[model samples]
Target: MRRRLERHLPRALERLAHCIDQVRMWQPGQFNYLNSSQYCLYLYFLSNTIWREERGDEAVGAATRLFLLNKALNGIDLFYEIEMPEVFFIGHSVGIVLAKATYGNYLVLYQNCTVGKNHGVAPVLGDGVILYPNSAIIGRCRIGDNTTVSQGTGVINRDTPGDCMVFAGTAGALVLKPATHSLVADFFRV
Candidate 1:
């Protein structure tokens, strides 16, 4: 496990730098321990891919998940085999899907968000995707980069373009629109 982490350290470092950049930290190293969320997310992916086939390592992975994330159990508890890039954030870690055969990068997930298979199909998410609280992306959908899935919205069997936002309409339907604000810049404010 240490060897695997060592091998992936540079990638993690780079990703951590990106996270620090996102937060606009003056010192990158200090931002690493600013909170435990970043480390937990890193361990979440690591526990799934690197230690998936190992028993002892998986045990450590289970402990990590249990200690950090609330929803995951039994060794990472990933819904599917996912490949995610770095500098992503997962809020509350409840019901957020780790891709049921999908890929993601720079993804941000809030509480109760799900991104997995609706039937037998999975969605492919691009970079800088944000799944707000209580949102979902399921089944054969394509989510482009810098897209925001707003609160209380769910996407199924649809394709969303880049630099857009998905919000719940008056009648509880999903509506798409051009991104008016900088997603990366105004994310925390929203």
Candidate 2:
């Protein structure tokens, strides 16, 4: 198990590096690092350290843990911290905050999205949930499986049903629709 985990470590590291590079390139003057590659390396180390601490043998699992921890400790607006099995986060960027919460597998968060806390309220996200850019889901809500929160949407004090599409605007009311694809496919489709 350990050897199998080690085999995938390099690929995990490469993904982290790529994420960091994209961030640096997107905001050249804003994000600063002593060395450009150090940020990714630090995340890579954190993932390994977290895995060893948790007694888990998989690097990808460890990386997810590290990512959640970093988001929590850094005062990111996330609300809950529940356990998950085999998670994947793509397109993480600066100002993206995840609440201390439990999310199911295949969660994708775009830039500037806030999965925030409202007092004791924390959201429970289901499998294959996609949060688009600038979307905000706050308070104690249950986001159903295969749900997509459109860009700039704010969902507060609501429970979304499974296989639904939700859209929010600055002034208009939030909208929910049926999803075209299955929840499992939303997670696996690149």
Candidate 3:
């Protein structure tokens, strides 16, 4: 596992530092990263430290223990093809999987959330995006920066503009609301 991680050693370390800085925990060689959320961030770095996408399956299997420790991450299988910038936080890991080759930055995913693909089409998320619990993004959608996918909403084959929040209506349709003045405004300080 360490050998595979060495492929992107610098980026992995940088992500780890970012996670430590954000989570505010400084314990080298120790599993004391505050909460399961913090550990999930660490596991993401490990998941992305592969040379090839197809090879990720083996790497993630090796990383299963870390995910199990967190318990929320029901086995984090981050496809190597999916590239992401530094992730800030993960509320819980239950049923969370970046199922295909995707891209994003500063991501926040809660429990039971999936940023997956439909018919081999993976979505591309922008910076500071949050996928709340029970929300699943599918197909070739583009989620703009600072967008929050509200709980229980499923997005498929759509383009969500930047700085917006998506909510589900009674008919299970999405409602795009402006991001300003919403809970996403002050979601994080780090």
Indicate which candidate wins on lDDT.
3
lDDT of 1 at 157: 82
Better of 1 and 3 by TM-score: 3
lDDT of 1 at 116: 77
Q: Rank by lDDT, descending?
A: 3, 1, 2
lDDT of 3: 0.67
C-alpha root-mean-square deviation, candidate 1:
4.9
Per-residue alpha-carbon lDDT of model 2 for 20-106, expressed as tens digits? Answer: 433323332232344423342344344644454444545446557656665554423332223432444445455677666667766
Q: Which stretches of candidate 3 lie above 4 Å from their native place?
A: 1-11, 23-34, 50-74, 182-190
Best by TM-score: 3
**Residue-wise lDDT of candidate 3 within 44-95, one digit each (tens)?**
5665554333355566565454335434444555543456665456666767
Query: Which residue pairs in candidate 3 collide?
Result: 72-93, 72-94, 73-93, 82-102
lDDT by residue (60-151, candidate 1, tens digit) is 56535433452343222343134555456655554555555555656777777777787678789887788898888889898988899998
Show the lowest summed lDDT stretch of 10 residues, model 1: 72-81
What are the clashing pairs of model 1?
none
Select the stronger candidate by TM-score from 1 and 2: 1
Residue-pair clashes, model 2:
9
Q: Against the hidden true structure, what lDDT does model 2 obtain?
A: 0.61
- Clash numbers, per candidate: 0, 9, 4
